[model samples]
Target chain A: MKKLWISLTYLVFIVLLIIPLIRIFSGSWAEGWEGFVEALTRPQSLHALWMTTIIVVSVTLLNTIFGVMLALYLVRATWLGKRLKQLLNSLVDLPFAVSPVIGGLMIVLILGPNTIMGVFFEDIGFKVVYALPGMILATLFVTFPLMVREVMPVLQEIGTQQEEAASTLGAYSWYTFWKVTWPSIRWGVIYGVVLTVARSMGEFGAVLVVSGNIMNKTQTATTLVYQDVENFNVLAANSVALVLAAVSVGLLLLMEWAKKRKGH
Target chain B: MHIEVSNLNKHFGDFHAVRDVSFTIEKGRLIGLLGPSGGGKTSILRMLAGLESPTSGDIVFHGKKVNELPPQERGIGFVFQNYALFKHMTVYDNIAFGLKVKKQSKDQIRERVMSLVELTGLKGFEHRYPHQLSGGQRQRVAFARALAPEPQLLLLDEPFAAIDAKIRHELRTWLKDMIERLGITSIFVTHDQDEAIEVADEIMIINKGRLEQKGSPWDIYKNPQTQFVASFIGESTIVEDVSKLKGFEDASVWPGTKALIRPEYIEVGKRSEFRIASATEPGRVKHIHFRGSEWMVEVTVGDTTLITYRSLEKEVLQPGDEVSVLVHRAYLFNDNDSWIMENKLKEDPMPIHI
Candidate 1:
C-alpha cells in the first residue's frame, strides 16, 4: 500500500509539473536555437524584460525598507496602544486576502486618469495610470506583505534583550540597531527580499490593469507573454515564459538558501 | 557611585510591579535584590538602569536627579539574566562594541579589550562567537563587555541563573572578588537566598512589590525586621502554636501568634547526649536525608515538625527513633510585628537531683 501511494504521488507530480515544463522548453526551441535567440532579442521583448526588471528592483527595495520599519514598529513600539497595534497587525494581511485582480481594480478606480488625485498628479508633471509609476505601485501593493510577514516573526523571536544590553553599554539607539538588531534579522530580511523580487517579477494581473500593456512604454514581460499568446505566436510566448520560469527557479533556489541561513 | 531611589513605583496598566519602593546604596558596595519570582526585584533593577521608567520616582545619583536620563547616558552597565551576548559577533567584537560606539581610537580600544579579555580569562576564545562558548564562558564574556566602558554603576539581573549548579557556585565567588577589586558599585538580583547571602555586601529582601528588609547578610539573618524576611532567608518551618513548646510557653504575648524555627536553632540528640536533659522534649525522627558531609533530620515534637542538621560523625539517626529536641530560639510574629523569643529554661537551669 505504501509503494502504491508513493507511485501515485510521483505520477501526479510528473503530470502536473514535469510535463508542462518540458513542453515549454521544447516549444521555445521549435524554430531551433537561432530562432529562440532572435525571439528573445527582439526590441519589444527586450523592452518588456527591462520594464519587469525595473519594477522588480524598485518594489523589492521599497518593500524591504518600509516592511522592516513596519515590522519593528508593530513588534517593538511601546507608544502604540494595544488595540491600535492589533488593528494594524491584521491590516498587514489585507494584500494576501484580496485577490490580485481586485487589488489592481481597486487601485485603478481610486487613481485613474479621470480621478481627482490622478489629475492632480498629472498637473504636477507625474502620471498614475498606464505609466511606470502605476505599474510599480500595483506590484508594490501585491508584494508588500511578503517582506513584513517574514520579518515580523524573526523580530518577535529575538526579543529586546540584546538591544537593551546595547543601550546600557552606552550605545545610542541607531548604533544599537546597526550592531545588535540588524545582524540578528539580516537573514530574515534577505528571505523577504527574495520573495518580493519573485512576486514582482511575475505580477501579471495587477500590472495589466494598471499599465494597459502599451508597446515599448509600459509593457512588462508577463503582459507581453499574454499578448503573444493572444496573437497565436506560440514560439515567442514560450520564449518569454521560459525566461520567467528560469528566473523563478533561480529565486526558489535563493529562497531555500536564505531559509537555511535563517535557521542557524 | 552612591545611588538613592525615593518612592519609586512602576505600574503596568493594572498590575503594580513596584509599589512605592525606596532604597539607597553606598559607593563601592555590592547590593543584592533578593525575592521570589515576580516580586519586583527585577523591576527595581531595570528602573535604576533606566531600562524601565518608573511611574513616579526620584533616582538621585550622587544628589543629581536622573529620572529623565536615557540608559545610554546613564553611564551604567547592565548584564541581563540570559547573558544576551551578541550571537553574530566574536568575543573580541562583543567586548569592543561599547568602545567603538564611543568612537575611541583603535589603539585604545585594542588595549582596553585585551586587558578585559585577560581579566575575564578568555585569552584563546577571542574569535569565537557566543554560540560557540559554554554557558559559563558566555557569562564571562558578558561581564567583560559590560565592564569595557568603565561605567560608574553595574547592574546584573540574575547573573548566574543560566549556568550549571557547579559553575554557578564558582562564578559567585569569582564575581564577588572581581567586584571588590574593581571597587565599582554593583547591584545584582537573584531569587536564590544562598547566592544573595554569599555575594552581596548587603542584601535587600523584596516581597509582593515591597521592600521587606535590607541589611548585611549577618544582620538580616540574625535580626529579621519582618515576618517575610524571617521565613524567606533561611530553611524555616512555621509553627502555629509555639506556646505549646516548653521553652516558648510564653509566646502568647503576640496575638494571632506564629513562629519561624530555623534548622540551626534546633538541637537533636539522644536523651543521654543532651546538655540539659530536663529542658529537652522527646521527639520522633520522621525522616533522615543525607546531605553531603551532614544529615538533615526532621523530628516531630508535640504535633510540630522541625528540621535540624546533624553531623555525620555522630551516632546515626534512623526514622522512628525517639530523640531529645531543644529549640534555642524562635522568631514569633503577629500581623504587624515580629520578635525573637529565647528559651526561658536556658536562663535558669534546674538543679541536679541525686
Candidate 2:
C-alpha cells in the first residue's frame, strides 16, 4: 500500500512537471525547426543572447568570489561584533525575500536621474539606468544570495581545526586558506556558482524594471522574449524562451551533480 | 629547544583558565601536563604553542621571548585530540603539506614525508585518506604531518583521548619510544595520571589553573607535594582526620591533617594477629576484588573505608571478615595542604610532639 501511494505521488509530480516542458518544446517548434532557426538568427535576438551570457557569467564569477569570502568571514573570522555579524547574516538573505522588481526600484531610487549618485554619474558621463550596467546590477542583486547561502553551512561544518593545523605547520595565512581550506569548500562554491548562473540567466522582473528594454543593447534574452511576443513574433519569442529554459535546465543538472558530489 | 613559561595567565572573558604558572623545561625531554578535565592543562599547552596569547605573562624559548610570535613562526608541532588530519588529502599529501608550503623541492618533500611515514608506522597507508584510516592510523598521520616541518617543540593535546581503550596503551608506548628516539622537546596534555606516569619523563600536575606539582614520575608518584597531587596522581586511601588513626594521635599530626596511604603500603591480616606496636586499625572487609596477582580488599573502619591490596598467596578474604590494617608508609599533609613528611609507624610508639 505504501509503495503504491508513493508511486502514485511520483507519477503525479512527473506528469505535472513534464507536460509543460513538452508543450514548450513542441510549441516552439510548431512552425518547424526552420522558423525556429530563423527566429533565433535574428540580429536582435542574437545580441540579446550574447548580452545575457555576458551578464550571467560576469555575475556568477563576481558573486562566487564575494560569496566565498563573505561565508569565510561569517564562519571563521571574528572581525565583527556579535550584533553586527548577526545583522549582516540576516541581510545576506535579503534577496531571498525581496521581489526582484523592488530591488531594481531600490537601485533606481538611489542611482536614478534625480538622486545624488545619479547626478554624480551623469556628470561623469556614465549611465546606470537604461544601460547594460543597469541590467547587470539587477541580475547581481537577484543572484547575490545563491552562493553565500550554499557556502556558509559547508564552511561551518568543516570548522577551523584543519586551518589551525595548517598554520601550526608553518603555513602562512594565505597558503593555509588556499591549501587546507579551499579543497574542503570547493564543492560548495561550485554549487553556489551554478545556482547563481541559473538565477541570473532567468532574471526578468528586475532587468525589465531597470534596463528600459532597449533593443540591440540593454535588451537581455528574457526581455527580448517579451518584446518578441508584444510585436506578434510568436516564433521568435518561443525560440528565445526555449533556449533560456534549456540553459536553466543545464544549470540545474550541474547543480544536482555538484550536490551529489558533496553528499553527507 | 628549552622553554620557559613565566607567570603565564589567561582569562577568557570572566573565566580564569590558567593562573600565575611558571615552569622551565629542559631541551629534548618528554613532559606531561597532567590534570583533571577543565584544569587548564590544555590552555598552558596552547599558550606554549602560540595558539593562545597569555593575558599577562611571557613565554620564553631558548632565552628569547616568544609571546608575540604567531604559531607558524614559533615553529611548534601540535597534535590535537581529534587528530585534525586533512580529510581531503591522502596521508602522503597531508604529511608533505608543510614542506610544500615551505617551497621545498619535490624530491625533498617526498624524502621527508616518506621518512616520517616510516617513522610513524604509516608506510603502507600513505595513499589512504584520513577518513579511510583507522583511529590509530589517523593519529599517526596527524603526528607525521605535524613533524614534517621539523618543529623545535612538539605539543600534543590529549593525543590518545579519542582512540579505543585497547589501543591507547599501545599508542602510548609507541609515542614514548618515538619521542625519545627523535629527542625532540615535547609536552603532551592528558587527564589520565597513569598515561602520564608511564609515558612522560616528567609530570606537571595542574589543578584549577594552578600548578600543583612538577617532578619525575617516580618522585611525583612516591612523594606528591600537596593533597591534590597525592590524591590525584595515584590510587591511595586518604584518611581525612589523622586523629582517628589508632596511633596517629602521638605523631605530632594535628586534628584536621590528612594522611594518604597507598594500597600497597597498607598490610592486611586477622584482627587478633595485629599488634599494638604498629599503627593497627580494625575493620570489616566490605568487599574483595581479584586484581590478577593481588586481591583488592575494601575494609570499613569507623566511618571511612580504605582499599588495601593483599597478595594472592594469602587466604581468601570474604566480604564479612574482620581484618586489621598496618600502615608501613603514610604521607601526611597539614590543613594548609602542603606536604609535612613521610611517617613510618614503628613497633614502639613514642611521643613526638614536634
Candidate 3:
C-alpha cells in the first residue's frame, strides 16, 4: 500500500509538471527546427532578445553591488538602532512582496512625462517611460531583493569575527572587506545574480506596463512572446519562450550545483 | 608595550557590561582576564584592543592615549575565541593578509609568512584552508596571522575554548612559551580558572562587570582580595554570619562578616592527635568521592558543609564516619564582599562548654 501511494505521488508530480513542459517543447517544434530557428532569427525577435539581455545583465550587475553593500550594512554595521535595522531588513523584501505589475505602475507614475521629475528629465532630453530606461527601472525594481536575500543569510552566518580579526591584524577597512568579507560572500552573490537573471529575463507584467511593447524598439523576449501569441503566431511565441525556458533551466541547474558545492 | 586602562566603562544600551574596570599591564608579560560568561571580561579585552570604545574611560598604550584610534591603528593583534581564520584563504595567505594589506612587497610578505608558518609549526599545512586544519592547528593559524604584522600587543579571547580537551593543556603551555619567546605584552580572556592559572603570568578576576582582584596566580590563590575572587578562582566554603559557628563568636571577630575557608586549609584527622584537641571541631563525613588521584570528603560541621581533599593512597574514610576538622586558616571579608584580613586560628587549650 505504501509503495502504491509513493508511486501514485510520483505520477502526480510528472503529470502536473513534466507533461506540460514536454507538451510545450513538442508543440514549439510542430513544423520543424527550421521554423523555430526562423522565428528566433527575425529582426524584431532578435531585438527583443537583445533588449532582454541588456536589461537582465545591467540589472543583475547593479543589484549585485548594491545588494552586497546592503547585506553587509544589515549584518555587520551597528550604527543603526534596532528598530531602524528591522525596518531596513523588512524593506529589502519589498520587491518580492509587491506585484511586478504594480511595481511597474509605480515606476511609470514617478518617471512619467507629466510628473515633476519626468519633466526635469525631459528638459534634460532624457526619456524614461515607454523607453529603455523605464523598462530597465521596472526590471530593477522587481529584481532588487534577489542578491540581498541570498547574501544576507551567508553574511549573518559568517559573522564579523573575521573582519574584526582582520582589523586587529592591521588591515584597513576597505582592504579587510575586499580580502576577508568578499571572498566569503562571493558564492552567495553569484547565486543571487543567477536568480536575478532568471527573474529579469522572464519579467513581463512590469516591463510590459513600462516599455509599451514597441516592436523592434522596447519589446523584450517575454513581451514579444505575448505579442506573437496575440497575433496567433504560435511558432514565434513558442520559440521566444523556449529560449527563456532554456536559460531558466540552465540557471536552476547552476543554483543546484552551487548548493552542492557549498555543502562540501 | 606597557598599557594602562583607567576607569573603563562600557554600556550596551540599557545593559552595563563593564563598569569602572581599571588595570595596568607591564611590558612583555602574559595576563589572563578570568571571569564567567557575561562577566565583562570580553568587553574589557575588546576595549583594550580598540574594538569597542569605552563609554567613559581612557586607554593608554605605551604612554600614548589610543581611545580614538581604530582597531587597525591600535597596534594590537587579536585572536578571536574561534580563531576566526579566513576559511577561503590558504593558511599561508591568511598569515600574509595583514602584510599584504600594509602594501609590503610580495617577496617581503612571503618571507614573513613563511617564517611565521615555521614558528607556528604549520609549514606543511600552509597550503590548506582553515577547514582542513584541526582545532589546535587553526588556533596556531590565528596566532600566526595576528603576529604577522608585528603588533605591539596581542589580545586573545577564549583562545582554548574551542580546542579538544586533551590538547587544550598542551596548546596552553605552547602558547605561553610562544608569547614569552616573542617577548610581547599579551592578554587573553578565559572563564576557566584552571586554564588561566596554568597559563597566565598574572590573573585578573572579574565578576558582574567589576574587577574583583588582580595578582599573580599564587598570590591570587593564597590571597584572594574579595569574596567573589575567593569563591571563583578556587573552591571554598563560605561561612556567612561567623558568629553562628561554635568557636567563632569572639568579640574581636567582626559582627556578621562572612569568612572564606579553603578546603585545603581544613585538615581532617582524629581529634586526639590534634595539638589543641579542644579547638578541633567534631564533624560527620557525609560523603566521600574518589577523584582518581585523591579523595574529596564532604564533612558536615554544625550547620555547614566543607569539602576536604585526601590522598588516594591514604587510608580510605567511608561515609557517616565521625571526624574532627581543624581550621588552619581563613580569610574574612566584609559584608560588601571586600577583603578585610586573614585570620590564622590559634589553638584554644580549654575544651568549650556547650
Best by DockQ: 1
- Model 2 agreement with the true structure over A55-98: per-residue lDDT tens digits: 98889888988888888898877657788889999999999899
Residue-wise C-alpha lDDT for candidate 3, range A69-105, written one tens digit per residue: 9888988789888899999999989988999999999
TM-score-sorted candidate list, best first: 1, 3, 2
TM-score of each: 0.97, 0.93, 0.94
Docking class of 2: high
lDDT value, residue B4 of candidate 2 = 87
A174, model 2: CA deviation in Å?
1.9
Residue B273, model 2: Cα distance from true site in angstroms: 6.6
Over 4 Å off, model 1: B349-354
lDDT, candidate 1, B66-129, per-residue tens: 9999999999989999988999999999999999999999999999999999999999999999
Q: Candidates ranked by DockQ, best first?
A: 1, 3, 2
Clashing pairs in 1: none
lDDT (C-alpha) at residue B59 in model 1? 96
lDDT of each: 0.94, 0.87, 0.88
lDDT of 1 by residue, A1-264 (tens): 999999999999999999999999999999999878988999999999999999999999999999999999999999999999999999999999988888888888988988999899989999988899999999999998998899999999999999999999888878888889998899999999999999999999989998989999999999999999999999999999999999999999999999999998
Clashing pairs in 2: none
